[model samples]
Target: MSISSAAPPKPTQVLPYATKDLHEVYTLGTKLGQGQFATTYLCTHNTTGETYACKSIPKNKLLFKEDYDCVWREIRIMQHLSELPKIVKFHDAYEDSFFVHLVMELCEGGELFDRIVQKGYYSEQEAVKLVKNIVEAVQDCHSLGVMHRDLKPENLVFDTVEDDADLKIVDFGLSVFYKPGEIFSDVVGSPYYVAPEVLNKHYGPEADLWSVGVISYIILSGVPPFWADTEKGIFAQISHGILDFQSEPWPVISDSAKDLIRKMLDRNPGKRFTAHQVLSHPWIVDDNIAPNKPLGV
Candidate 1:
């Protein structure tokens, strides 16, 4: 007797957060952005007529169990921080055989980095305000037990095109829920913003503050503190942790600002300032300092 051999059928991937049919609720429109795993679109509610940004991830892209888990974790993290004013609000999620749709608040003002760059020259007062919002968001995330592994200018956006628009944090794809003192070994984060300890393959929430410091440095100086042509070189410089405050803008930059950056960017994660500490620092809290002088680009 001859027996035929065949492989067993794979289990179906299911997304718990996605229940409703996406097409039934919202009309997916123009493409906003595209990433490796998902494509974001301008979507409008069919009934309410409200507009939103919908990130649609195709099922085929989830080639592994870890990919699906990452998607689920992102949805959970967004929902966990939904109430935060600085975080992009997660409205709903939907799933079908083909895709998983995530509906979120629409940020029409483009990226925070773009807005700052367009302004050409901004004062320390302006930079302080922007950094304050970012640090406050970080503090909130930490307090809620979420670590945003990726924190960079591109991830920060303005809710509207208006001058007074609120800066909202977006893209929690790399974030994870962590307990106090829990160490993560994964080297996950943008090259320029990533902390040295992250490169060392061991880090905690303090890594976020290091990114914040890199952002602070960029906002004040219009350039990244660590610079190199290649990713490897960049990582090397970040590992070295030497900050350049001798550049054109740094000479005029306030001492208080530099002090805060020094504290936040400390090579030793233990010595790095917590989000709360950065928020409470005199440079961040006191309005009297952080001069209003325009930092020339």
Candidate 2:
């Protein structure tokens, strides 16, 4: 299958609470994010006053006949891996002809993409810490047979607290549940982060790891390695397994960081390091490792 040009309207959407009694569990607020298929909002539960993120997608998006089946697929996968910690917490999902509301845990501080934009890129030590936490989270997802088809800096949200900030992975709209020996053929994910096999229409969990590699490269280099002049060129580059690391304006990165990228970006899925393997790599295990040290701190 070739890459599709059709894009969604927004990244997320927010819907009004229609329950009869105005309970605390359904106080809707401002829009958090909007996608082509759905929208998310920050809401406050009536009784507890606790806030949550509600992703409301049209009911039609799930009933087939919709432009993309991704929204429904995401709901299924999220429901399956709802118990994982780092994965976005699923609160409730309901549909009423007009819309489907997926209530999930609220994470403040926005996405890691915002932080990256603010700080440019991260230091090696900082990158390692963040990658470590993310690896642990992905490991959790893999353990539960979930593979996040889209794993980018923007999908990582920060749960900001006073002293301890937690990294939570969100945006499961492209995720899928997998069993051993299953072969996924969907050519999905951001062009910049997609694995080579995905471009060839043969993908699996390793595709997710390829995205991780892109995020890791961004964490260290402050830019993507496989950038192209056009959409077609981007897919072509990804398909041909050409990574532009030597392109100028590079940062002062370590060999370990580069090595990690090389391993994760390997064109052959069989050769790409598993998330667990990446976690155990020497770069993540060196004596300098620190659990909570902020990236580039």
Candidate 3:
């Protein structure tokens, strides 16, 4: 959709958050966050006063045709997932001469990674609740032919700080629609959480589940199962690294939890459990475990 330029608002000179590339429908608030290609700001509706987050990306920075199309793809993907549960809600978007503005639901609880760091850890029971929500989101995405190329704790956010808050998966910049068995060649994702097949540049939706495995390991241990001092070492570890479960915290972790990770992190992508399969895993489906135990150390 194109922006309507029907009537220019008078007193345009003093327009706050108004640019040729953005609309005055949103009144800019405090700065929320910034990233490589865009900066997010808290915004409010001019008439409704409802809060939202506006991602402002400079159009000039899109030097290549692919870069421009990538943004549009993100918009389309978000539109497709507009009503999906456990996902950040997308409102609408606008483009002016300078930037593309994508308005999304404002999440107040911040990143799941921050919670993991601050709380020291979560029990398998607690982690199960979180992972189940995430896997369901992923399963939904896959069902719709969407592949979240980048899946990590950093992209997971909570709707609020409440214990029962919904854990929503956000960000779709690297996401794409792919059919089952289709392959992708471009390498994309955070180094630590990427699947081994992603490094090989030939992978499908199962690659995302591998990242889920990495996230599962992190949620239970407060540390990634694989790590290295350098990027090369990290990649080496991902390709042939031994998942460390013999250390301190592993003894206390339930075997079911470890087994879940093992199946997802398997080197062979073909053998990795899909998101739907993960939901039925013993670790995720068992809600009868004893009270939540802290495994943060």
- Residue lDDT tens for model 3, 1-297: 998776433221211244343456888899988889899999999879999999888877777666777888898999999799788999988877677888999998889878767666567788888888889989989989999999998799988887788989888999999977789999999989998899999999998899988998888777888899998888899999898888878888888888888999999988889887888887887777523777744
Where is model 1 more than 4 Å wrong at Cα? 1-11
**Could you say which candidate leads in lDDT?**
1
What lDDT does each candidate get? Answer: 0.91, 0.75, 0.84
> Candidate 2, which ten residues in sequence have the lowest lDDT sum?
13-22
RMSD vs true structure, all candidates: 3.4, 6.5, 7.3
Rank the models by lDDT, top first.
1, 3, 2
Ranking by TM-score: 1, 3, 2
Give the lowest summed-lDDT range of ten residues in model 1. Answer: 9-18
Clashing pairs in 1: none
Q: What root-mean-square deviation over C-alphas does model 3 reach?
A: 7.3
Please provide TM-scores, in order, for all candidate models, with all chains considered together: 0.94, 0.83, 0.90
Reference-based TM-score, model 1: 0.94
lDDT of 3: 0.84
Q: Which of the two, 1 or 2, has more lDDT?
A: 1
Clashing pairs in 3: 21-96
C-alpha lDDT of candidate 1 relative to the true structure:
0.91
